[model samples]
Target: MGMIRFALAMAVLLSHLPLTNVKFIGGGLAVQAFFVVSGFYMALVLNGKYTDRGLFYTNRLLRIYPAYFVMMAIAAVFLFGFKASGTATLGMFEQAYTNPVTAIILGFEHILLVGQDILFWMKIEPDGDLVFDLANAPPAEDKPWAWQALLVPQSWSLSIELMFYAVAPFLARLNWRWLVALAAASIALRLSGYWLSIDLGLWQARFFPTALFLFIFGMLAHKALPLAMRLPAWTGWAATAAALTLIIFLPLAGLPDGAVRWITYVAIAAAAPFAFHVTRNLTADRWIGELSYPLYLTHLPFIGVVLTYEPPMPVLCAIAGSIALAILLFVLVDRPVDRWRQARAAGKAGPASTMAAATP
Candidate 1:
């Protein structure tokens, strides 16, 4: 499971780099795959480790925000101080903060990470008013997209993740039938947009409601954990291997991009419980898995810096630098915070074991 998580993070990192004609599961698929993984883990914890919803929320926040703020601070320095340009622009900042009300609202979103995802559905007018732009067009000479003000632009996914965390406990309590019904409804909504010619580009990927099905797939996977546990341990290893192979090689199989994506999602959802069953007890694997989140959060800044400097082997440099920074963050920030989070959970739920430490 850790290896799978790391591979998905790497897929996202590589996708963001300015590589040409590379074939792999893209950042979009990787993100959706991550949602599946998040769903599985949230189900794992919500069902077992968290008896108190308040404790679950706070532990989840601790898991996310510490490393996030550290990365956000680094991103702020690059964007505002050094004036790096990829994730955001100075013009976008000026437009965002031009009106006091807009500034306050955008500022709150940036700090709280609650509304950043909806920014994809809006654009900033020249007068600093935000208006709905379902098309999600690119920023023009006068109008800037509201999401452009995000210092860590990709943190939009975190907004989605936070929303999931908000309702996960309740969702985890549902019977498998109810869970399936909800997932079916969400998937129906996603398909209905395309069937009805609704042009749901803005909503399809970023919207929480449409994306809920992927997470529910994961929840369903957790419900299958007993089956996985009853299987031979080697089955877990086989499942992990098969899933990774599919992720890495499916693009070369000459399928439509959409088909490949759904295939990957189904493979991941099927493999997750088995993978987690095998990897949950391995200390080394868990450590590797811990790097995935910080790696995801911090990669964009390093990519921005590397691309700006135009170093030799820029892609390699970006990947190496991102991994190095991720390790530092894991060691310096995430580990300690995780200890506190785990301690809090232990206080509430008895002892905190590796199986109970599942995170997306």
Candidate 2:
């Protein structure tokens, strides 16, 4: 699972390179992969884990926040301190708007990864002339979509994932019949906006519900399957083929961007987690796992540095620098956090294990 995640991260990283737009764009498939795998794992773990929701949420909170804050701080310094002048002239600069209060709101939204309601204004440039809209202009008399607010573009998915979490507990308590109902609701959400718009929390698009359905499918699969049984060989192959085909051919067909996204998520949910589980058995001795977290944590800053400066620094140096940053982050941050999570989990697991052993 972690390797799949690493691969996805690599895909995203590769996609961000200035020159590799087309080839790298395929990396977006990785998130769908993650969602599928997560859906399976969550189904497997949610019931057991929810016995201690506070602890489950806490561990997740801890895992996500540290690296995120570090990255945000780096972005802040790069955007504010280094590019202060450029930002003042070209971007939003004043402390009055995106200040401490903003950060606090964004910080919570960061955990969920959606800041959709973070209000702001937009003004289309005219005649190539720069125009700044007054801060927080009231919506035009009848216009509901005057401006779009985005602190981080990636966050839209995160918000939907958080919505899933809120609903997960109810789903967890549901009998199979209710899961069928929920699945229907998800589909309805997806199709409701086909002619208009899907009201997927805040996205106002079909992607969220489409992806959510894949996730729900994963949950259903886990609940339906025997622990010893792999997904039927033919079912698995068909899904993998379908997903890959859509991903490769849909754009060429002029299908909406969201169509490929849905296919990718379905493939991911249905296959990736199981594949990762198999891979772990085959490559349990690999070295990448130890460095993966740190690598994930620090790679963005490394890319940002290169991109912010001499961006096209020959592919070799860029790769080297990224690897070096990953290695360093592991040595410094990842190892420590890993040890912390392990020790904490071990501490909690200890008494139970000992009691079981003693009882037996």
Candidate 3:
């Protein structure tokens, strides 16, 4: 699973690399895979790890925020700072709004916004031919969708993850029958939008109940994990190879982007459980897996900064810098948090054991 995740993250990183919009395994598919895999892992943790909702949520936050805060800080310095210095004017940042201090504050503020709800109501008046309308604007309309509000545009997926985290405990508690029903409903809702021509847009796909099905897919995968683990090792490798091939070819096979994506997610979700067995004890794969989050979170801004500077080997430098920063974050931030979580869990277990011992 770790190896698979690293591959998906690399797929995203390659897609975002500066030189080309080369679709080497669609980034969108990779993101859906992340959600699917997340669903499965969260199910396992909720079932077997912390029973306290507070601890679960806290662990989730710790897992994400440390590196996230660092990435945001970097974004503020490189992206916002450069924009504020009046050196580069992209479509995303406005010249009048170029106060570096304000940009910095707003950059942090955006992370707190979480999702599009508060920003959806905002309407930026067009002054001097710049139109900023949050509700109806294109995803690339930066004046309304500034780094100040989004921090990192791609982090929108994190907002969806937040939504999933909020309800995962309750969802995990449901009986298998109920969970299956919920999954069916989620898929139905998404398909309804497609059939009815409702123009549901990315919001419907990104953070909707329909997306919940992917997580449910994960939950189902978890239920099957024991059986999956019993499969021959060759099966794992074969499924993984087939899934990757499908991911690459599906988009180019002349289907609509939406259809291609739907197929890709289904294929990966089916294969992910089997692939998990393949990497169960692989150390290097796990290390690269741990780096995947930092890579996903920081790569865009790192690449953007490099492109902004037009330094020699900017693409190469962005890849190197992003990987270097990801490894640093894994060591300094992510691993420490993992140890803290383990310690906290052990402490909680100790108290429970002592109480049980005393009662007997």
Give me the candidate number with maximum TM-score: 1
lDDT of 1 by residue, 1-360 (tens): 998998888888888887545636888889999999999999988877778899999988998889989998998888777776456678878987988988998889888997798888888899888888776667786788888887778889998999999989999999999999999999898877776533476667888999999999999999889899899999999999998888677788999977997898899999999999998878888888889999998898888887677889887788899999999999999999998988888777724334676653
Give Cα-based local distance difference scores for all models: 0.85, 0.48, 0.67
The C-alpha local distance difference test score for the whole of candidate 2 amounts to: 0.48
lDDT of 3 by residue, 1-360 (tens): 665676778778877774765565667668887888888778767766656788779878877777788776776686656742111245435532455654554455466636533333233332312233424454333334343344455666776788899999998888878888998998788777655533455445554587888888888777776777788999888877877677555556788877777776677778876776676566676777788898887777777767777778776887788788888878887888777876665455432232111110
Model 2, residue 85: distance off in Å is 13
Clashing pairs in 2: 36-269, 193-197
Indicate whether candidate 1 or candidate 2 has the larger TM-score: 1
Arrange candidates by TM-score, descending.
1, 3, 2
Q: Ten-residue segment with the worst summed lDDT in candidate 1?
A: 350-359
* lDDT for residue 167 in candidate 1, whole number 0-100: 89
lDDT of 1 at 23: 34
Models, CA RMSD each: 1.8, 7.5, 5.9
Of candidate 3, the 10-residue stretch with the lowest lDDT total is 351-360
- Where does candidate 1 stray beyond 4 Å? 195-198, 350-354, 358-360
State which candidate has the highest lDDT: 1
